[model samples]
Target: MSCRVGSTSSAPEGLWHWLGSIPHWIYPTALRRDGALWRQVVLWISGICLMVAVTGFWIGVLRLRWRRRYVGGAFTPYRGWMAWHHIAGLVGGMFVLTWMFSGWLSLNPGEYFAVRGPTRDMAV
Candidate 1:
């Protein structure tokens, strides 16, 4: 029997790794029923996530005034919840953007990490 990825949509259980050949109907090895295109799906999803992180960082920076201060000479006009948002966005947003960027880079969409197969000269 061959093992398959779990749909996770209906299955209450979390996830499972494929250690050996097992029937897919019996047990799935993934969280979704993405079939063989799971990697591609994840790549596209990662791109969206990266864009969100970038937008968040951009907003965080724009919300703050550098040269011109607020009424009380404050760099930010936000107060209470908004103030917390500004602080977290300025600080946490950086970390989130960095993490998403690194993950996107790791995907190697430009074939930068491509490997060449054995040449004809190589021994059989």
Candidate 2:
């Protein structure tokens, strides 16, 4: 039948309900019921990706800066595909770092503001 959209049940019904139910089909009911495990998995993967991205970024930066300087100039390293590879890695590493960091933060959502609680009395 008909699915309720807002207060009315006369809403157009095609694949909207099916599309919404896809998540249920993909993830197990237990995982859906308790999101802690899912969040932990996401955090672990994102953390690992973040570390890899950081190291890759450092290696790319170092190679582009120091290693290429002796050959000729930093920008003009190789005369063919290798030069493009170096440029791509340097640029792509920054994007990867940002994406992984954002994903990690998403799984570990926290409050930015720090509110202090009541302090204990010195007399007590």
Candidate 3:
């Protein structure tokens, strides 16, 4: 008799199994094999992205405040270009912040959330 935790077949059976299979489909075997290296890379990238989002938020705030104080209306430095820049920065900054935060959390999930069972090993 054989015992299986999530599924008896090769295909994932439940939400947990589907979630576990994500890394295998997304990341390359080489990256998965060297978990330490992959983690370091993610940390560095997430850090950089966080820094960028912070700086962008600061710039946007400064620009908006300056325009409101001096110009007394919606006055962008570059007019049309600056308008688009502000819109993109405001919307895209949220996305960058969230994505980087999630990436950082993924490095050591046990710290933030409970982890069950033994860690999965890379097939390669």
Candidate 3 per-residue lDDT, tens place, 74-100, comes to 545546777898868877887877877
Q: Output the lDDT of residue 5, model 2.
A: 54
Give the least accurate 10-residue stretch of model 1, judged by summed lDDT.
18-27
Tens-digit lDDT string for candidate 2 (3-96) = 3455643444434753466443335466666777766655665677688778877876766555436455655456678888878887887777
Candidate 3 has its poorest 10 consecutive residues by lDDT at: 1-10
Ranked by TM-score from best down, the candidates are: 1, 2, 3
Q: Name the best candidate (by lDDT).
A: 1
Candidate 1 TM-score to native: 0.62
Give candidates' CA RMSD values in order.
Answer: 8.1, 8.1, 12.2
Model 3 TM-score, all chains together: 0.52
How many residue pairs of model 2 clash at the backbone? 0
Q: Order the candidates by lDDT, highest first — what do you get?
A: 1, 3, 2
lDDT of 3 at 73: 64
Whole-model lDDT values for every prediction: 0.67, 0.63, 0.64
TM-scores for all predictions: 0.62, 0.55, 0.52
